[model samples]
Target: MNTLSYGLLSLLSFAPLSGYDLTQKIKPLWQAGHSQIYPLLASMEQQGYISYKLIEQTDKPDKKEYTITEAGLAQLRQWVEMPAEHPVLRDELHFKLYSLWLSEPQKAKELLYQRMEFCQSELDRYNEMLGGNETLREERGESHEPKATTFGRYMLIRKRIMDMESSLQFCKYALEELEI
Candidate 1:
């Protein structure tokens, strides 16, 4: 299945959420906007992957709360069991990198520096969220030590942050090498 379907199913698996919350979360994680999420949600509903109920909060207007259906859960199970596909890296930054030579070298250098800064900022944020002594379990007042499976997931996220930091360092070195 596509990322959108997998994302929707994953979010619903955690807890029922409104389309708006889903959209907001997707923006940061998947780089998707509402235009993409709303249509996909409609399509998933049509395909019987999910169902929604109108929820009226005491403090707010009625909202559609989405939950995964049986089919969706089954699909999620299959997805988890299946071998992961080789991830195809689609880097928008790379596109900009290649096109940079068309303009002044200084301009290209400036852009790359800006991108490195952005990556550094994101790495810092992820580190704050997932790294160090303070953790999700700690924040929730649960056991300081998490289950092995949860710890594994946490390590994976940490690895991703490290990978981003590595990429940022590479960009910094490349910029210096380019003398831009």
Candidate 2:
């Protein structure tokens, strides 16, 4: 249930996107790396969560466009309505924290500072993207001006980014407190 496959299924609920398009959209927000996304897509298909059809384009090679099945839709609905779980921090971060004891305190502090800077940059990018950028809508082939539906989704993403930023800030403070 922790697999990002749920997010992929939810994205397909909006529209059938190619795996490439899905990866592109997800990269800026979620941690759906290309390596993770394609394999998950294959697994979802195998498990009957989704299905894809080859879309033949006049100007391009055929693409696999993914669509959610009824079962997938049911699962998505259940997932969305489920109460939120406590966030599971990434294992990499935990590993880095553990490694702090092995490094010079100043070096550990520098590492945390670097992480904080990265988080800030990510937050800025998320904010920019959510700031009524018409380009994304256009890229999605949306003809109308961005609507409430799109904006609402963007807001949800923005909230998640903000949460991550807050967590990063907290980590930064904790690192400083540790004098590391």
Best candidate, lDDT:
2
lDDT of 1 by residue, 1-180 (tens): 587778778778767888999987665456677788888888988889899999988988898889999998898878877787787789887788767668787887788788888888888877777756454545434443544334534655677698788889888887887873
Cα lDDT tens digits for candidate 2, 1-180 = 454888898789888999999998776547868888989999889989899999999998889999999999998889988897787666576787777679887787787787788888877777777666775555434453445446546656668687768869777686868863
* Error at 28, model 1, angstroms: 3.1
Estimate TM-scores for all models.
0.76, 0.67
lDDT of each: 0.77, 0.78
